[model samples]
Target: MRHAETVTFGGSGLDRAAALRSMPDLMDRARREGTALSILLWRGKPLVQAGSLDQLVRLPMDHPIIKSGRHVDADSEILLGREADGTLVFAHDMSSWLPAGLEATSLNTFLDASEQQHPDLPQDAVFAELRRIMTSLNARDAELAATAKALYSWHASHGFCACCGVASEIAQAGWQRGCPSCNAQHFPRTDPVVIMLILNGNSVLMGRSPGWPDGMYSLLAGFVEPGETIEAAVRREVMEETQVQVGAVRYLASQPWAFPTSLMIGCEGIATSTEITVDPVEIEDAIWVTREEMAQVFAGQHPDIAPARKGAIAHFLLRNWLADTLD
Candidate 1:
């Protein structure tokens, strides 16, 4: 898609400097050079210096304020990277520290709060704030969020080792949890979800899950079950949701949806049948809308339909598809 990379959290071409991830000497040198900056996460919500660039905020490691919030112990290592200017970048996990206004709330509660308030957080103002403090964030922020949230959730739910039912300890910069009793190593997990646009000429299939706001519809999606390929998942999900037979499923794009780590595998599927049989358990409704109708929905002019939420892969893929760039 021509504007695929232009989307928020799309490829920003940041030079991650991956070779340095394992080199302690190089990492130390970069840290001492004052090029090392950290992005702070308060209860999984990235800290934004109100009115800054994109969503960028500062995390100077040596700053007096940060030193006062020394939650990381000497035994813990942080994830580090390098900026284009040879500066070091790090991700700081403040899940240990109590977040302001969130001291008594659990992580799940915090996430719920963020979701409920996100639409109200002035987007342009937040982007402006992020831009003022940092030039840009690497596309990997989405990946990192996915990794961290998945791992953290795993640790939260799997405090006991699966091998021996013993408690596990966080290790390897929060990447792994070790079971002292059984020597078991546990890692983060990601669930694969297939979101497909099933097309029959000019119209595309869309559905809405129960409980979603009225008039909201999106591409049919479902989790890829064990031993299922992406193509198989797309076909199965679409068939299961709408009883619409799909053929020739092809990959289009992907997004890391980190509401506890899901990889959204976007695809295009050719419809072999148009007859709709809604799975009342899986979806509340299903319908096909032509390109012209889709254009109206995107423009918020459809009297009975609402467009997909911005910044979501559904909207991203739909926009590209309408522009005939879903190549």
Candidate 2:
């Protein structure tokens, strides 16, 4: 776990200027001075340049699309952080705007087709799903985009104050929502999920959910319930899903999974029993695969299994486990 922070969306030591966020005219100053760097989102997808999919395209605060009132009147505007060079970074959610007369495509297909319709924006810019190309992005861009997506998602769902059931106003530079009626403050939430590699001798326990792509299996994972520890969550999840008791859970690494914001706590657990009683409600299938079989799956040689998605924590833990580097 020495290299744990190298995981995707792990903190890269960006300067999150908390003090600047409290200033009353922060957004106003950014708009007038042109000293802001804006990350653009289209219905929760980050904007990327067309040809070079690896690079993320950031818009200047004064750019045409950003200035065109749609972004100025964004659904949720977040102050992400500042750079070492003193550039203010922000995120503008453009989920409310759509290209006129353009037929809506599935989230999977919008990435490739959206760029062709928008002639007003940069010729190379296209909105793409973050999960599809997370590993290709550099550390800074990955962190910023993940932060933006998480914040936007929180705003979309949590419009009302939980304490008083009153509508809340955005405050504290998008980190908080303030309720005037009850004087309650609400903060962003990150649910903790335990994803464990359960080991029984040389084999590992893997499971696939009902709707996952065919042949896609990953490490057993479940959310940490109220007052449950990470270790307990891992053991309970494995037992509940596959009826296999786990012991000696050890922390491995973690990643910020921003598909609506969940912190994946990776772990390795030793299984005490080998019974395979699959819970049909939770998982479609569960199996014990040896290291050799996993290697074949990773190399695209396995007949009936697809490897875990490349940028996910499951894939990272498995790769390190195979290399004997999961210390």
Candidate 3:
């Protein structure tokens, strides 16, 4: 775990100026000082400029063309940061405008086309574009995608205030929603998920859900229920899914899984029992694999198993585990 922060989306020293959230004058001053830039999001996807796939594609703060756009009004933008003495830092939304490749395309159609090519886009490029220019963005692009997807989904479902039957207004830089009638503040939520590598000497346990692609097994994971501790959740999830007894859980690392706002807490657990008895309701299959077998999966040489998806914490952890770097 010495290099835990080196994981994708794990470390990026961006200054998330939290103190500037409430001061309007400070934010304006920051913008005027030219230290502010806009990250644009279109339909939840960050807008990446062509060819700048490795770095954040920031928009010039004073770009005349962006300022003249009809939909580029003040309300569509949010101030994200300010310096120590109060300076405006901003991010703008161009979701109302067409993206680079889809100038005349509809959002729905554009999404469909993009999905088809998603697997082919360079990981760095995809990550760079979404991290800076999108709503719900993170310092890492994939994390941003996950954040945007989750937050937008929440907004879509929680349009009405839970405390009172009134519409809520977005606030706190899209991180919260407020109900005017009931005076309630609702913040964006991140669910806790425990994903663990259950180890028995040289072997590790993995499971696949029913709907997953063939041979797509991953570390056992489940949501941490109310009142459950992380170690307890790891034990409970393993028992529930594979009927295995786990002991001595050790924290490995964590990733901000924006897939609808989940925080994946990765851990390693010592298994007391190895008999596989998968609960059909929880997992389609559970198996113990030796490190040699996992090496094949990672190298794309496994006959039946596909490698874990890139950008996922599971993949990150497994890769490190294989390299004996989980320490």
User: Best by lDDT, which number?
Assistant: 2
Residue 54 error, candidate 3, Å: 3.0
Clashing residue pairs, backbone N/CA/C < 3 A, model 2:
none
- Quantify how close model 2 is to the true structure by its C-alpha RMSD in Å: 2.1
If scored against the real structure, what TM-score would every candidate get? Answer: 0.79, 0.94, 0.79
Query: lDDT per residue, candidate 1, 1-327, as tens digits?
Result: 545565544465555565664566766665577767766554455555353233545556675535555753332335534556766666654556543464454344311423111222333322121111222444655444334445455556777899999888876545567899989988767789999889999999999887677899988899999998999999989888889999898888777665656778888999999999999999999999999999999999999888776667888889888988887
Instruction: Please give the ranking of all candidate structures by lDDT, highest first, separated by commas.
Output: 2, 3, 1
Question: Judged by TM-score, which candidate is best?
Answer: 2
How would you encode candidate 3's per-residue C-alpha lDDT over 1-327 as one tens digit per residue?
997766556665444565666666765665567766665555555545345433444556666635665545344555444334433345555445443566554344211325111222333333223323332334454333344445664665677788987998877666578899998988777889999989999898988887676778888899999998999999999999989999999998888765456788999999999998989998898889889999999999988777666656788888898999998
